[model samples]
Target: MQSATSPLQTLLDLINETLSLILRTSLTVRSFAGRWQPLRTKLASLQTSVADISDSPHWAENPLLYTLLPNLLSTLQRLKALADQCNDTSFTGGKLHMQSDLDMAAASLTNQLRDLDLLLRSGVLHQSNAIVLSHPGPGSDKENLSFFIRDLFTRLQIGGVEFKKKALESLLQLLEDDDKAATLVAKEGNVAYLIHLLDFHNQPWVREQAASAVSLLAASNDESRKAVFEEGGLGPLLRLLESGTTTLKEKAAIAVEALTADPENAWAVSAYGGVSVLIESIRSGTPATQTHSVGAIRNVADVEEIKAALGEEGAVPVLLQLLLSGTITAQEKSANCLAILASTDEYFRALIIQERGLQRLMHLIQDLLSSETLEHVLRAIASLSASEPCARVLSSSTLFLIQLAEFIKQGNSILQQISVSLLSNLSISISDGNKRAISSCMGSLVKLMESPKPVGLQESASQALVSLLTVRSNRKELVRDEKSVMRLIQMLDPRNEAVSHKFPVMLISAILAGGSQGCRKRLAVAGAHPHLQKLAEMEVAGAKKALQRLSGNRLKTIFSLTWRE
Candidate 1:
């Protein structure tokens, strides 16, 4: 308590003390409303003589605690610095009250920013305005804002928990602006940010939408790819190929598809162990994931390391398991993988066949035939028939034979054609195993021959039946049994090329091979014994003539009444 001083000096000292308090409160970057209006009133009373002092360059810093002018960029910086401080734990721990203060300050500062933005747009002030936006330079330009934004983004990227979250939210919001949005999210830069979101974000919607945005932003840009690698985006994506949520995993896979189109990215994906993940995903993921993952792997399947990695991953067992468990799309992809292996690795092909791969393929074909999923069934069958071991695998299934018979019983000409082709291949390359398989399917083959249809199918049918006669156990039962002799003779009537060419050759071969057991007895009882004897005598008497007549081509055309002219 010193002696009383002059009234103006008291007021000046009081104002200086209040400014000290102002400095302290702002050190934590929080606003203080206590006595704010009263102080403002007091400061306003004293500003009459403060006019010339305000024109100083530093006047914008403060006017003895009556800081005004929303256009002052300093105030905006102060607000942002406060947000950063609040985000930092150490800065806010001793200052819980700072958050509310910041909220208030931010609200006020935001209003001022809006006003300043309007003023800048209107060009009403002495300062350079939005026109200055058209041509950017070093000082006091939009370029500074760009640099500031980029710095904020970088800080957020490597920042701690709270700070990083705030940084992301702020940056995301800023991107909603049209002009400011383009500054950073140029097509290429967006890719980096988006890949990071896929790699790091735990929110599904966030990851999904960010990935979608990335898709649009990267639509044509060849740049920004380096940003993806620098952010460690590839490894996380491969890992995500397994564990991410449905939507996120899909987006991540699509992103991988886009990035891996470039050779370097394909290598990058492989180097990150993507092949194993993708192959395993075929077994464990949803049908859609399996499909997409297969496609992803196919993109790099030509790479030796990627292919070797897939093999080492025990993909065959998983693929087999998927054949037992997966959806149609998964089955398609599994078939494709098998095709790749069959063409590229003989040992792998042998391994799959040894594991009853052909049995499963045959079973799948039957199911597809039943379901009328023809394209996939054909593909699976094609995959099977291309290899010898696959044929061995083919002989193991009795259920397959039953289904083939039913397929022919349906009397679908196409099904008959396929069955004939399959049986012919089997009979032509006869093995003990194949005979057993044909025994299973022979009933179905006999049923197909009994039905009536186009002449073209008869020749293949005859050839197939004749080959069956080569097996002694099946001969008398098939040839002489149940009015089959009449069908066989009618099939060779020369009205249809198929029957004409195939039936006689096969019939003559069967009779010669037969040499009159139950077939001769049955034909004698059926009253065709003389006809057969004559045919046999004719063949014996004119061997070369018989051969030439058999060799002459027969062309018969059968038109369906099923379709209208």
Candidate 2:
């Protein structure tokens, strides 16, 4: 006969076995051939069962464990069966259709395991309900965590420095792993409490923790973020960034980043003299600090007034420095900010070019980085290329020209559009070398126009084509390609009368300007004449001219006839 175990010991044994099953099931399902939708449903159901058991009013009582253990065991049995089915080789069809669902299921199972482990290991379940309300460790019950936070919120104003610091630290921790808990903390008025702490707390660690907490809490909920700005969080945050220690400055920058996520917060940031403080942080703080500072600036730089303020405060020189020397993240942020600033103001664009930023950007593109980083680099370059001096520099660089063409063919859609726009600028006052490079890529441009890309891209691509057609040789090359005339005809959609009526219409006129009979016949056969005539009725000069050119070719052919009359 076997001896029966104590109730606590039996419950602990059940928890350990349940955790083992979860881990083993996760592994088996992960290695299965079929998609894990079946496994995901099983795990989610198991997690829900555990949550329901935990949420029961009698959950904290030891006697209830005996009652709940059978339900948990039943769930575990079903989960194991489902896991076995997932691993069954006899199942058919695609093997990885629901990878995302499988991933989410795994995470859910892991969280449940942690919660159960916490429930068993904490050893706090007594007949009496007088457990100590201390800071929560992993998998602490939500009720306990919320109670602990409520207690701390009461102490935040009147507590000693050490107590206040501890409260802020605990609050920051609770917010990190659980958004629901973060919401509770914010709803308890802890955000307002922390903002006050950031302003008046004498201890550096307290302010740092407070700033850190504010950042997370503000970002967690829309209401919390709005509350932070409404409660005057910007001034304290800016002051922290201005004079606090490096760690405090880093934390303050985080809060500022979150605050600026709302466009309305930008004004508060600038009004509180954050422009100067953020620039200083970027210049002097560590790399992480620089990244956050630049993020804050990027959020605000879109506002023209703030942009001029940053420029007035000499942000350009320091931003250029960061672009050259900072970490990869910092360089990315710096490039993004410079792109916006330069795009908004021509003076800033010229300044960036003179500071050798353009040359660095060219090199960055050639480094073959990710598309995201390359997009920012190209954006700044595109803006710079619009300036005559910068255009000359970019056009003169064979490397830059080649990279732009490569981007057009292989980059994402936005990158392709930007590349074509820059090419258009380069083609203006284009040197013969630049024209040759661009003309070599005429096929790529025509393909872009034919793609189902956005109308803006088609417009830009057509503009670049128009500029390239300025060269007589390029115009002849366009007519020689069969797809070019068809593509031009496709662009003459009455629905898109804006770009269709303008740039594509101009392109057809230029191709016909070469007066090739074959090109004219191709356009007519492609049914361009009707669309062109429609444009001519609308008083589009280019359309009228193209129709006239095509009509002249027809008249010439008739006059050359030797028919009997």
lDDT of 1: 0.51
Q: What would the per-residue lDDT of candidate 1 be over residues 1-565, giving only the tens digit for each residue?
A: 2313533334434444443444444445333444233333333332322233223323232211122232223443454455456445566344456646555665554444343333222221222231121222335355545543443343334334444455455545444433434334452133465567766776665565665544333322344344454566667667667677776566566656556655666777667767777776676666667666665665665566776776778777667666666666656556666656655766666666777776676666655433323433444454556677555444344555445545555635666666565556545655544454455345455545644465445555666667766776666556545656565554434444333333444554564464544554454345443443444454543333333333222111113333333
* Poorly placed runs, candidate 2 (over 4 Å): 1-131, 134-148, 155-166, 199-205, 302-305, 447-457, 492-499, 517-540, 551-565
lDDT of 2 at 298: 85
Candidate lDDT scores, in order, read 0.51, 0.71
- Give me the candidate number with maximum TM-score: 2
Per-model TM-score on C-alpha atoms: 0.45, 0.66
Q: Give per-residue CA lDDT, model 2, range 1-565, as digits (tens).
A: 0213555446545755774676576665635535455555555555554555444433444333453455456555555655666666675645454445455555655544444444433333321232233666778786766556655664454344655666566677778877677667766544666788788867767777788888787677777788777878888888888888888887778878888978877887777878999999998998888988998998888887788788789998898888777888777778889889888888888778777888888888877466766788888888887777777788888778877888787778878888988887776666766676667678779878765457577767877887777777887777777776666776786666335467777788877777778778877777888888888898776778888887776677677784633
Runs in model 1 with CA error above 4 Å? 1-204, 212-239, 242-246, 254-272, 286-288, 294-305, 354-393, 405-421, 428-465, 471-565
TM-score of model number 2: 0.66
Cα-based lDDT at residue 464, candidate 2: 80
